[model samples]
Target: MSSTLHAEQPGTSSRGTPDRWESQRSFDELGRPLRDITFTVVDLETTGGSAEGGSMITEIGAVKVRGGEVLGEFQTLVDPRQPIPPFIAVLTGISNAMVADAPPVESALPAFLEFAAGTVLVAHNAPFDIGFLKYFCEQQGRPWPTFEVLDTARLARRVITKDDAPNCKLSSLARAFGSTTTPNHRALSDARATVDVLHGLMERLGGLGVHTLEELQTFSGRVSTAQRRKRHLAEGLPHAPGVYLFRDHERRVLYVGTSKDLRTRVRTYFTASETRSRMGEMVGIADSVTGIECATPLEAEVRELRLIAEHKPRYNRRSRFPEKTTFIKLTREPWPRLSLVKRVLDDDADYLGPFSSRKVAEKCLAALHDTFPLRQCSDRFGKTPSRTPCVLAELGRCLAPCDGTVDHDTYAAVVRQLRDSLLHRPDRVVEQINARMEALAADERFEEAGVHRDRLAAFIRAASRTQRLSALTRCPEVVAARRGDDGRWAVHVVRHGRLAAAGVIPPGTDAHTYVASLRASAETVAGGPGPVPVATAEETEKILRWLESPGIRLVDVEGEWVCPVDGATRHLALHDAVARSRTELVPFDDRRDLTPVHQPAR
Candidate 1:
């Protein structure tokens, strides 16, 4: 990175004596006075972009400088636990193999933060790096530190003579300063060069008596001129879903973002109130804003994902959050055992989670066991059938499907009940629990009622996790497509009112085409609503075939749009719209005058 800017030794004023330089008439007209200040210049490589959606940082570097002199520096490689794009590897020369052996981000970020403490941040493009750092810190439950930021590129344009230079590049500045060192693209080198350039700008501006860090932090270019440019850029933006890139005068990317409405989102940062803080600082650095329009909201999400993945833009947060959070998997087997597993595992088992904690998963399982009474014993114990039932049977905790006392069909029915409970249909669980609790209470079985009450609480806890409930008579399915404003599309596969999977298709593709493809694939399944085959009565399979299929994405499922790919049933919302429209329609004969002759009766 520093190769772009040549490194210079400290205390070397290429210009005349400081006092004489300050007296220059040209410096007084064009520059602000410079002040001694400390700055922490930082940079990061990340897995992807959107902070909220999912992205992680892979590396970070920070250099501390005071009064144009280097104090210390910090740098580290982060293991993202995800595949690194080939281009990023080539550009940063930090390969997947390199990071693969490094400590994960959890261990590296805190160290970087400690080094960055107590200094104003300086970056070639500060917003991109700082935004990502802020977002990542927030996700880790760490407090984000606030600091003034100075953009070297912005300072260059303001202080450098346009007549003397054809272009304002870090390399050009390094060359002009007669510095021999070339900064490498790696974090440290770029940060170092940025530091050098900042020093040079300060030296030139010091002649104008604008000599303190505080003044630079609050510096704004010609008020009317800056406002006019901001307004012009805001006016040119279109109201569409798309990604926007903010760049400074030196053409370094400052920030990348996706918005449902580009014009509105971009314009917000230009308003008077927004311009006073970090965003204002960014605008001050930015010479132009560029946009890439997406055809639909989903396409915008996909593009944002791709860009973040590709560029590792500093401001995105999507990659920093945990991707393998744990959840409970209640197998669709005869025994229907519940087990804890990470959400990212590739196992041939039915799973549900990305839940916040294991306690929540356990509570849900316990409630389901109480309500459905499915066989919870291990298969080894179940097959060991003794003359008397196991402890579970004695405690009324199992229906004893093991001893042939409960038929296979009956056991399967119980399993279905357990599955429904796991799917968050608490009404049935509540009704059954209420009846059992009432029976025990009426019989003076106070202990049993109390146990049932505890189970009911757990049931309610699980139900409360879901935000919506579907009222479909049978399992619901939906095929929905989200088209981005740039014509890209995202196809979602929903099953039993849950988001099962999603796929991104190329831009300009029709939403209906992808939905139709999913529908065709789902139609081949045997027993379930999806394309997975179910076991026959003779096959006492340990797991349901359809439940183990890899095709399903398995997200929070609910509503009439369950299997959106099927699209056989229309949502009530759509029906209501049609109904309302029909009622408002007027016949042509009643509203129009057919005769050209004058209306004498009027």
Candidate 2:
């Protein structure tokens, strides 16, 4: 992590001015040669996953290198202020005691920033490390210094082939190249390993004619020759936040994407940075790229969803199939049963979804059936006893409405409860399902309990999302504003959950006048059939995400925008915890060491 370059590179003199070699050596106009650029390779170990969620950096390690020689190193452990999660502590071997006496981020950040000043920053996964640094600076009210960033993993992806290494992970690349140090999860060790991987990748860059830093930045090892030939397609695109559409020879859209910088993002399609094989193929077939600039990132996002849904692009996988979403319907019959339907009709049937998939909708319906005595059979009853009771009735799983065991009025009451649980109130449903799960677990029915747990999670999440979206769409007019980092305000006019209009208000502009004008010019959107909005659920859901994000303020509202008190919001944490357990492959019953361990100050 520490070495000195005795010979101060061929281009510069001892006094730090350019020498004769600087003028004679050929270089690209975009930037300096890679050999002359100084890069500060950095790595950080944090208390947990996200900075915004109060996850703090536990250790910082960086190595400054230029011309393949390490210039200096900086490493320090920081007291996170909050206790570290036991899993994180075990991962990095940095227990609470290890950082008890160390400086906190308030003291440690400035030192690292100063140590790595005036140099390009490099990290294996640059976003995670850089995000923590940027967030810390914001919290401290310190101006983050502008520094060029290069991800070694991205660099490796551009240079190293699958034959050379399996993946771009630091350890993998370190082993691929005969590195002197091995990454051991500790910050300094990983940073040192990354420096070796960087050098090895730089060496391979020469064969690809990536001598200049600019060329190296855009180089991708797997980018085909055909992709490079279509680089001109990105020309004339504005470098602003918006949506971009890649069109085929017939002017049909092949793909749609949103980006903060339209030109840079579209340009990546022809470069190694665009790694998705499907995207590369799309770019190969693309005859042109069109950019639609928007006032804010929120608008860009909504526009992207709309464009993708409209075009149903072959290359885009997500929003293209939004119509395939299903809904859990309370059947409009004498003895109503839960049914899955594709569309929302005006038949007065209680609906709880627009679920992302049929499997999730089925899970939600299963939860309802497990809790209530709703008929499991699909047979329609004509008020009187028409058919024999099924086994579900004998097992006490159903009310046997078909055989007159349960009257229409009683069955209707149960249907009302189910609808209320799915829509306005979910507390009873949550309690009932949770109690069932506990009872099964008490009986040592772990597998059955696990199934119940998943169904409960799916039910709650779907209920929460549906209620949140429904509340927004129910509002006739809603106006909101979010202040950007640049001191401008992004104002949005939502009419029945559709983005009617979007604009930005400058710092000095009068907010009142600007908002009024935006509202006046906004689109006149009528309420759609039933509880839905004029916009699609996916589009409205995107608007809801922006409305709920931090810094968003409701400027005005024409109608009520509220979720029920006993709604799914209360159970959202349980849903999140269940999802996290499933993702981490942890047993649902194992709650130990998941919470932060507050070791007494050493």
Candidate 3:
């Protein structure tokens, strides 16, 4: 029988990574078949139940086999340098005298490991044997070699039943399968018996279509049959950074995601690792998984956001409603009231958001009102107004342009202050809010202070986000590079804060030539109307995050990329201060506090 997989010699690909051994063979692209997988069936007799309890291995035995044929055998007795308990000596028949003349573990373990190298480790209960080996390596200060392991007991529990075997014990299973060797508590005897039981279980699993090593490993888990049946969708996917879309029978996208390794990430959906409840349902109905390879992980992230926004897949909740984003629109009217709008138009009015929710936009609007007395009412009016005066006018909270109380020039001045606060001068508004909060705190009105604090935070956060995004969006073109782990530079071109093109330049390559080619092929973006470009807010936000990351070098820039000197980004510290205040423990209700004993309901 063949003892090794039908794999070709390893060779380097264009990317300087080893070519997949499975891809060059006539096997399932997902993984090698069970028959081609070699396994080392091992057994150990130790002095105690666990390695942590000071147990040490007394005897070790393993049989290296493939396709029901034994390729090699290993057995040794180790001088544990300690006394074996009476019960353990009786149970395993290995006594101190047996290992007194044997070699010590430091001398014996290396030989067994070399013999079992490059094969899957298997045992009746694998953790017991593997754990002891790992502990020995740790104690000896030797690094443990990574090995793929399988437990015969775990596999048996999935296929065998009480009716077939009275118990999952090695002796009971040997009898049930009519093994050629019966387990007798000795290491070699038990290991030989486990080999037969492993073959028996594999034969039973074969009927269930568990033909491949990957399937066998995942078979013991709670993977659904529907999920397993769709494993073929992961075939032929490049093991590169990319975006993947899971589509239904109608070719409609069901989900979209990004990963550094396409095949590994998509394959996890078919295994038990994908535990998200909705993902299982999505996989059940998914017909195919398609991959779009990217030059860098950042590009993959940008594509993922754009795809989710474009398709609005039912499985993707994030970035699905970029169109539904509400902005605090400073309307272009004689009485420019703050209006929460969903669409950003070319009307040349000032806008402050891309806020995810209307409630947040309203809070920001309230913050603006608290600072500048822009009209709150939505009524459009000419110079001569006909609407009734509201409470805000009586309280001097508004200029009350609706009753013709304030001229357009005066209201316009207040509007300019707000616009400057939104775009150019955020401190003009933040300082006043800070002063008001201090006054409220001085009056001991802590609850009202908290309310004002949160409102100011909302405005500062929105302003900061908008300013950061605008700084990138206003720039027509930006080229940046960051070195990757493989000594290559990942270069990307941004057009109006959207990832237009991306590529990688190998070490020692002419960066200028490569960047020129990237820029030439980049997507052309026309200047948009507002401070933000035509790109979706989420897309621009992702680009800005990548740009601000450490080690990102700006190779070239077209337009000026600068934030206002008094931009909201400068007030981020104050925003974070308010955010930190929320986590602090404070009195739940200042009005109703007991002094350990309710003092006369006062």
Winner by lDDT: 2
lDDT (Cα, tens digit) per residue for candidate 2, span 1-602: 99766767667878556876445443335468888999999999887657887678899999999999999999999999988653344346677888999999999999999999999999887877898999999999999999999887656654555667666667778999989999877889989998998888778666555677887776643667999999998889998999999999999999999999999999988876666556767888999999999999989998999899889998776789777878888888888888888888878777787788899888888988888889978876588976788999999999998778988888889888988898888877788877776666557565677677778878898888888888988899999999898878999999998999999996688999999999999999987644454777878888988898999999999999998987997767635633532232211111111122244676
- Stretches off by above 4 angstroms in model 3 are 1-222, 384-388, 441-444, 506-508, 573-602
Please give the clash total of every predicted structure, in order: 52, 2, 0
Whole-model lDDT per candidate = 0.55, 0.81, 0.80
Q: Across residues 1-602, which tens digit of lDDT does each residue of candidate 3 receive?
A: 65644444458554444667435642554677889999999998877666776668889999999988999899999998998644345445666778999898898889888998899999887877888999888888988888999988767765665567765777777898999998877899989999999999888777666778887786643557888889999997999999999999999999999999999999998886664546777899999899999999989998898899889999886789777888888888877888888877889887888888888888888899998987888776797896778999989998899888898899899988888899887886777877776666557565676677678778988988887787887888999998877878999899887788999996677989888988998898887865465788878887888888998999999899988887888766635532431221211111111112223554
Cα lDDT of model 1 by residue, 554-594, tens digit: 33223432323212122122223222211212111111111
Ranking 1 against 3 by lDDT, winner: 3
Worst 10 residues of 2 by lDDT: 586-595
Candidate 1 TM-score, C-alpha based: 0.34
Compared to the true structure, candidate 2 yields what TM-score? 0.64
Question: How high is each candidate's TM-score?
Answer: 0.34, 0.64, 0.59
- For model 2, the stretches where C-alpha displacement exceeds 4 angstroms are 1-221, 442-444, 506-510, 529-531, 584-602
lDDT of 1: 0.55
Tell me the lDDT of model 3 at 536.
84
